[model samples]
Target: MTTEPQRLQYLEAMGLTAWTARYRMPNARPTEACEWELPVPDDGARQAPGERLHALLDAPAEPSVPAPAAPAAEPRERPPAGERKARALLGGLVPEAASEEAAPGAAPEPARSVESDEPREALRFALQVACLDGRWLVVQPGQAAPSPLAQRLLANLLRAAGVTPEHPPAFEAFHWPQIEGLDVQAPLDEARQGLGAFLAGRARRGWAPERLLVFGDEATLARVLAIDDGRSTALDLPAWQGPALETLAGSAEAKRDLWPRLLDWRREWHGEAKGEAKGDA
Candidate 1:
């Protein structure tokens, strides 16, 4: 059995106003709120629950009273010092700097510069040096070996000058960024030094050539020889710079240009040799 207050609460939840009797019957038990009373019609006619609900719905609603204003709450106290520090440490792990809203009209922080300690990329270059028929020929084939067409053209050019080198000519291939290991910082300087030493060692051994023929970039040859100009006799030897064999093989104009230079160089160097041979004869 539900109590009187619970029964009243159920009726109130159903949108119906509950009423209490003003006077209690002789055999009725006392209610929890004995002093409180509500005047209700005591007509002898008892109505069903549905009829009572309908009558209550038909009745006019009472005027509503405004609730009293609540007092303002006090400001909350700060958390303990240790708790605040722990929260700060946790927040520091994963920084929210990027997520933070930027201030209006404020200058942004400058970007940080990253410094690298690794060695710079190795300098890349390719060349071939050969000693042919008592003459040094510094060639920049731009690869391991010259193309067959370039090689054939070179042989024809040499033959035109009436010079014959030994079969299987001695070739020295020099390439930069060798070994792909340590101690290769100054590659350009190292290349110049290594080539210079090779030439110096050959000269010391009494195999110094009387002439120098370069079939590549003159500027590059000059740098390797530590000379101001490739055409000048700064190395104490007759020198001539000509187009690369690759260029001569493909272009008729290049071959035509090279023929005259080849003839002039051969006459100057070979003529001296011939005159010396005549005197010796």
Candidate 2:
């Protein structure tokens, strides 16, 4: 049987207010707090023995307040005598400055310069191209267009190779310069993987050429080969079996050196020359 407080808690939980319907005897004093027993269900519709026991066990338990926890122990202080002795020993072991007087004929060691810890500047350059058919892809340092001088130089190179700006070549040019937002200073392996994928996609779309004329600095070539030796030379790409000519990127001098080489390559591609196309610079 529950107490008066428990009964009142249950009634409150059930959303009902409990009150006593008191009947006062004439001249009788008020009684102390009273508890009324709740009516039990009839045994005719009785619950199973196990179920009754489970209900009794599952009833809400009385809440218990926890006792206060013990305070933590304070850390021990260090002994001042030991600390002072350590300080004294360290003071006694002080390294004296080297003697100004050098041993006879003994050469002094050269002072080593301290290297800067600052990161080196990122390599920056644009790979630009001008096709025989007046199509231009002029990538600037920051992914912008090539200057007019650069475009004119490319045009002159194309003319040297017997390609007129009015007429497009039979084969589609491999457009490497049009790659947008390319980080030139990205890790070699990562850049090569991305470039390989790009090349493969272009090849799938019938953009594979017999020969690719890559005009870029040593760094660009290194990016293509995924190496850092600064050697720029012809190598076969995964997408194309033909040679990819790596030439110097900027300036009129570089273009002048490249035109004759491009002319020879164009001749070989057209079957005009008897020997193999010498695409390597």
Candidate 3:
């Protein structure tokens, strides 16, 4: 009984993908949903019940910030630890790399895979999720929307602390010329590359923003993040951390308050998503 517009509305409303076991209508009875198992954008078919519900949302509706700039020259490659931690530590958080087939018989492609090798749960990052200009806003400085509050606090703190902020975002992927005493695995530039790749997903099927913020409710944030990818709804940054008080860019309060909230969001959603995934399983 649902139409494409209605389906898209749900997607827009939720701001992410829905692969859980429950039907979108909550009231609607469950069906096999074989048709929806196809890829998005031109995979036209009068498919499963979920399609009618999932299609209501739009794609490319949000704007992603540019990642942090790379250093003038590639940072000297640090030695990869010959002996690292357990590989599956991230398994408990992300569960599986997003690379698993979305549906039973779908083709293997980059869009269908979401990956995290690090043990994300133990890391810390301040997730800031925001939307503006009819497009979703990312916190990537230079590329991300400028937040006066964030920039002023982080920049001042970082410069004084000798910590250089990465433009693309993420500490693991890039190199910080000025920052000292941070032992994150990747540098800012490198981390941003991974985050950038995630956003390229069909929709907002990317990482959990450490600092998830929206003008409206959680639903608003979800919609903007997933606008480009039909399958993504919300974001989660399991591994986000900040510099020490003497070595950070933002105020001690902002860093403490903002980052913890981001982690709290993950903790809450992690519980919920785990439940949902289990239900689907």
Name the better of 1 and 3 by TM-score: 1
Residue pairs of candidate 1 with colliding backbone atoms: none
In angstroms, the error of model 3 at 70 is 87
Give the whole-model CA lDDT for all candidates, comma-separated: 0.56, 0.42, 0.36
TM-scores across all candidates?
0.45, 0.33, 0.19
**For this target, which candidate reaches the highest lDDT against the unseen true structure?**
1
Compared with the true structure, what per-residue lDDT tens digits does model 1 show for residues 139-191? 55466677677677777887776566664345566654443454444445555
Worst 10 residues of 1 by lDDT: 74-83
Which 10-residue window in model 2 sums to the lowest lDDT?
A: 237-246
Model 1 misplaced regions, further than 4 Å: 1-123, 166-170, 184-187, 200-207, 218-222, 225-228, 232-237, 271-281
lDDT of 3 by residue, 116-150 (tens): 44422212223333322212233332223345555
The count of residue-pair clashes in candidate 1 stands at: 0
